[model samples]
Structures are given as structure tokens and as C-alpha cells.
Target: MSNSSNVTKQFSAFYLENRLYGIEVGRVQEVVRSMLMTPIPLAPDYVCGLINLRGQVATAIGLRQLFGFHSEIPQDLINIVCKVDGMLISFQVDEIGDVIEVSESEFEPTPQTISEDIRKFMQGVYKVSNSLMSAIDVDNIIKFLNNKLK
Candidate 1:
């Protein structure tokens, strides 16, 4: 067995519907407060809008809608900026949390109980304190969405 499984990895945490979600820290460019977005006409429901960060533009994806959430969109949404397929994309989440470190040994396969909508995008889960953090695979999501749009 390889010792690489024992390595510790850090994740940027966020919340949606009171459930914890995370993404590998290295993949995250930065998290920022909501910015003004230019709405895209005829776009899917999950596409919130396009945001201009400094001089760069990023497509903001509503994680809530993407995850099939039905709750009212919160007043203050956070953006998790990431580079996917050489393009900067922003994932809009409900709230932001601290950076969390968990050993690779702590990683577990996605629970069989998770809904398929969410399970498809989750790489796995890590048990942290009293909660389990589902790791989001941003690239996987983008690829799926791209194929979906094609």
C-alpha cells in the first residue's frame, strides 16, 4: 500500500442547506462576496450570471440550483472562484466556512444515501468534527455541464 493515502489535504469549506461542502484548496482561486452579475438570457436555471472580477469575467454557477435545491435563494451568496478548463468560473454558494485539513486516510467513498444529483459531483467525503464534508469536483461538474450543453 502507498503511504500517499496518509497525506493531509486542505479544503476550502462552504455550506448549503446546512450541509458542509468542500473543494480542494489548491483548485480554489479565492472566495469573494457577491458581485454584480450580467444576466444571460435563455441560459439554464443554474447559470446565475456572469461576473466581472477586476478585468476578468467569470461565469457564476448557482450551486443551489445545480444541486436541485428548492430553498429560496439567500440574500448574501458567496463566490468560490476556480479555474476550470482554462476558464475562470465562480461557484455561488450559500455561505463560506473556514479552511479545513483532513488526512487522505480519512477520506471515504460517497455515501450510498446521497442523492444522485449531488453524488455525481462529489469526489468523496471526509469526516470533520461533527460533520461530513463532501468534496466537490469542480472540473467534473464543468465537464458534465459542457457535455450537457453540447
Candidate 2:
């Protein structure tokens, strides 16, 4: 019998505050270079601004802020466009990493040692070589954003 734990999943990885993070490749629409953004007035601090993506406006979310990182956003950024709840959203990242394939056997639950701010949105983590790549929970992210807006 084939072991499910041997199955591998692909993730589109990125960096924020020097930590590695990944989102399921299936939900990722595209990764793009930084583009001009129009700041939204009175929007939550995490909602950095809006981007013009091929004439479609996408909300640009500063992952650092969303994750409660108290650091200034870098001038150079990468946009990881993802399809969440049928809406196109752009996540502003500090740097972009390659697509990673990790086996299910490497997965582990988020540790209690992690801070609540960052841990809340983590689906889990995958042991990668010498490091752990935290998995971002896209659904929780959208739900949190929705709640913030309401």
C-alpha cells in the first residue's frame, strides 16, 4: 500500500522578517515584481494599499504588518497573488523564494512556543533540510481580514 505520508505537496514559498513561509501552490495565482501602489486611506495598517494588476485592482497586504512584525516595510517588495474566496488578493512580501516540494512526513503542528500573532495563521510547518517552513493558512487569513473589515 502507498503511504500517504510519502505524498509530497508543492508550496510557493516566500520570506518575511527573515522567516520562511509557504502557501499551497494550487491557490497561488502568480508572483510578480513590485508595482506602484496607491495607498488606501483609513484602511487597516496591514492593508498597505492597492495594486493595478493588468487593469484589475488588487488589495496589497503587507504580510509583515499582518503578522504583527514591528518593522518598516522594505522599499523593494514582491507580490504573491493568490485566489482567496474567489477574490484576487496580493500579498506584499520582502522576498520571493522558489517553489518547494515537501513530503507529508515532514509536516508538524505549530508549536506552542511560537508567538500567537504569527502562529494563529499557520496551518502547520514542514521540516525542510535544516529549517522549518511555516505554512500559511489562506482561509484563516481571509476570515481574519473579513472580520477586521466588519
Candidate 3:
């Protein structure tokens, strides 16, 4: 028996300094614990330099830098890596959260009053339980890198 009307995509939520952030699980290649970052000279503040991720050079990006936040990043944080535009890009997040699934109708528009930094990175908001997890826009993040390189 095949049901013709039951389909839903799953999402993984991560906690970046207590705020809920969601990303499509399919986009994620792997998640690993925080590792020592080798700083690169003349690199933008956001680029924490490259890390030797199992023989692969993964560019570590500080989420804090992307947001222009002045707060200090914790000493212990992990890098979430994924293949972005054929290059391995790793994001520095506070910690990995749970994976949740919901109907397509659950996606909601982001609040207009959200901060410019947050707004720029998120596609929309996913209301999960008591908090709203901003869905990370993969394309937007890639666009940011392009703009920076220009």
C-alpha cells in the first residue's frame, strides 16, 4: 500500500549560543568536535583559518564574525562541515542540537523586526516548541563568501 499524500522533510537544529538554528540534514556532510584552529595571516576576521580535517583542508568560519558580534567565542566549540559549491566549508557552532521534522506548511516567515545580521543569514523561521529556529540559507552564505572575495 502506497500513500499518495504523506511526505515531509527532516531538519537538524543546532544551538548557536542558545539560539536555535536549523539546517537541512541532507546538506550536512559531517559534524565533529571542536579542534585547534590554525589562524591565517591577512585573512578576514571571519575566516578563522583552515583546519586539517582528515587530510582535507576545511576552512573554518567563525559564526560570530559573520554576525559581527563583539562577544567572545567559547574555547570549546565544534566545526560543522559541508560541501558548499564543491568546496568544504566548516561553520563554527556552539553545539549540535536535535533533528526535527515537520510538514512543509510549518515553515513561517521571519519576523520583520529581526536583527539585520540574523536576517541576512536566515531564509525563514521554523517555530519549534518554545523557540524559533532560523533556517540557514545555504545559498545566502555562499553569496556572502562571493561578496567578500570581490
Candidate 4:
């Protein structure tokens, strides 16, 4: 067996509906406070809209809507702008958590019990103290959105 799975990585954590999730810290550009988003006509429900980040337009995604969560997204949510496939995409999360350093040995494949909708976007889960942190695959998310938009 290869030891590559034992590499350690840093993750930028966030919360949604009290559940913890994270993305690779290297992919995260910045986290910004909630701002007005201009809605796109005929856009998918998960597409929250677009935001002007500095001078660049970033597409904001409502993670709650994308994850099939029924709870309404709070207005005071934070935007985690991530670079995926060389494009800036913003994920609106309930709240920003901390930067967690996790070992690859602690990573586990997404559980079969997890909802299929969410499982698809997950890279895996890391066992954290008292909770599990789902690793979000930003690339997969972008691909999912692309397919949905087609």
C-alpha cells in the first residue's frame, strides 16, 4: 500500500445548518462578509447570484439549496470565495469556522448513509474532535453546476 494517503493537509472550515464542512485551504482565496447579490434570471435555485468581489464578478452559490437542505439561508451568511478551475466561485455558508490541520490518515470515504446529493460533492470526511468535517470538492461542485446549467 502507498503511504500517500498519510499526507497532512490544511482545511478552511465552515458551518451549514450546524454541520461542519471544509475545503482545502490552498484553494480558498478569501472569505468576505455578506453583500448584496444581483440575481440572475432563470438561474438554478442553488445559484444565489453574482457578487462584485473587488473588480471581478464571482458567482455565489447557496450551499443550503445545493445540499438539499430545507432551512432558509440566513441573510448574514459569509462568502467563501474559492478558486476552482481557475475561476472564482463563492460559496455562501452559514458561518465561517477555523483553519483546521488534519492528517490524511484520519480521512474516511464518504459514508453510504450520507445523502446522495451531498455525497457527490464530498471528497471525504475527516474525524475532528467531537465531530466529522466533510471535505468539499470544489472542482466537483463546479462540474456539477456546469452540467446543471447545460
Candidate 5:
């Protein structure tokens, strides 16, 4: 094992829209329950769509739809705040899992050329023990939704 891998064995993987997505333990800023969303009629369906976060309006993007999968929403829905394009945005998640530290070498590069929408949503793949967490770039997600709506 390399020096970095010697210090850790797991990392936190978050459950969003039914997919297991993980980030470095240091990336997450905060976790909040699913905020009440305001319907933006003109917005695309993938938008899921918008919510008023405190005094600022934050758009909630449906990761499931973006990935071309059925949504997991019905009961458990949560908003996970992370830096997307340097701006804090709320992501609709099913539940937030515990933090896990893992080997840095476990990360695998995403295929540059994904042939489908589902594959496009995945930024990269990071393995956690026996589980696979798809690391998504929230920034690209926002851009994709925005462009689709427009």
C-alpha cells in the first residue's frame, strides 16, 4: 500500500436519488432534509425542480432523471449542499450515509466517451470496499440541466 492508502481504508458515500455517490471526506459542507420545492413550470422535468433555501432560491436537480433512471423519491428525500461551480447548491438525496475513509488508488477515471445519458452523469468511479460510488460533477449537472431547459 502507498503512503496515502496506509492512512485510510474508507470514505463517506452519499445516497442521492438512489445512486451511491461519494466524495472525499473533506468535500461535503452540510446536509439538510429535502427542502420544499417551488414548481418552475418552464423548467425541464429533470429540474425536480426548485426550492427556496433560506432567503436564496436554490434549484434542485433530479439526479435520477439526469442519469436516465427512475427516481427514488416518494418518502425519503434530502438536500445535500455542496460546492458546485464555487456556488453552494442543494442536491436532492435519499439519505446521507456515514463517512468512510478509503484508498486514493481506488478511484478510477470515467470513460471520456459515454454513449448514454446515464453514463454521462458519472464523473468518475470510486470503489469503497465492495461498493461502487459514482462521483458526479455537480457543476456539469447544473450546466446540463440549464442547457436542457433553455
Candidate 6:
């Protein structure tokens, strides 16, 4: 079983504040620099707004606000566009990192020390060289947001 779980997968890493997080590279559509966002009135606080990505309207989400962080979003943001349930959603992150290939053996369950809000959306944690990278579950995130919107 352990040997079966040792398959390697690539993840696109990004930063929220100082914390590192990652999503499966296959789920990521593209990463774009800061772009003009059109605010959606009556939307959840975490929903930053909408961005036109190559003529497609993508819903932009404020990753910090979604994680219950009270700090203001930085002026320069990097948006990681991911396809969840056939829909494209953009996650605004503080900084974009590299695409790291990690083996399943290096993945561990999320620790209890992590805050409740963040823990809910994480699939697991990967033991990187210098720091732990929390794996973000895009499906769960989309489900949660859909529930909130309903």
C-alpha cells in the first residue's frame, strides 16, 4: 500500500502571507499578474470580484479573506486560475512560487496546530525541503463557495 502511494505528483506552490500552500498542477489553468477586477455587489467578502481572462470571466477569490485572515490584500496580487467542476475560478495569492514535484510518501495529514478554518480546506501537507506546504483541495473550496453563494 505504501509503495502504491509513492507516485509523484506536481504541485504549483503559492504564498498567502508567510505560509506556503499548493494545489495540484493539473488543476491550475494559468497564473496571471495583477489585473483589474470588477467588484460584485452583495457577494461574499472572500469573493474579491471578477476578472476577464482572455475574454472569459473568471471569479476571483481573496485567498486571505477565505482563510479568515483580517489583513488587507496586497496591491500587487498573483492570481492562480484553477478549474473546479468545469468552472474556472481564480485565487488571488500574495506570491507565486515554483511547480514542485513531490512524492506521495512525503505527504502527511494536516497537523492539529493549524487553525480550524484553514484545516477544513486542506487535503494534506507535504514535507518540503525548508518548509511544509499545505495542499489546497480545489473541489472542496469550490463546494464551500457554492454553498456560501446559495
Error of 2 at 130 (Å): 0.6
lDDT of 6 by residue, 12-78 (tens): 9999988999999999999999899999999989999999988889999998999999887799999
lDDT of 4 by residue, 23-140 (tens): 9999999999999899999998999899998888999999999999997668799999987777789999999999999989899999999999999999999999989999999989
Provide the RMSD of all predictions against the true structure, rounded to 1 decimal: 1.1, 1.1, 2.8, 1.4, 3.6, 1.3
lDDT: the better of candidates 1 and 6: 1
Better of 2 and 5 by TM-score: 2
- Where does model 3 exceed 4 Å of error? 1-7
The residue-level lDDT of candidate 4 at 122 comes to 100
Candidate 2 on 18-43: residue-level lDDT in tens? 89999999989999999999999999
- Superposition TM-score, candidate 1 onto the true structure: 0.96
TM-score of 4: 0.95
lDDT of 2 at 129: 86
Question: Tens-digit lDDT track for model 5 on 121-145?
Answer: 6667767667777776655676776
Report the lDDT of model 5 for residue 70: 69
Clashing pairs in 5: 9-101, 10-100, 10-101, 10-102, 11-100, 11-101, 12-100
Model 4 CA deviation exceeding 4 Å by range:
1-6
Indicate the TM-score of model 5.
0.75
Candidates' lDDT values, in order? Answer: 0.93, 0.92, 0.80, 0.94, 0.65, 0.92
Q: What value of lDDT does candidate 4 attain over all alpha carbons?
A: 0.94
Which 10 successive residues of model 2 have the least lDDT summed? 83-92
What is the Å distance of residue 66 in model 5 from its true position?
Answer: 1.5
Candidate 1, superposed: residue stretches over 4 Å from native: none
Compose the digit string of candidate 3's lDDT tens values, residues 1-150.
854235565677787768888778888888888877789888888898888888988888888788777777888877888888788888888888888875556677878897888788888887677777788887788788889866
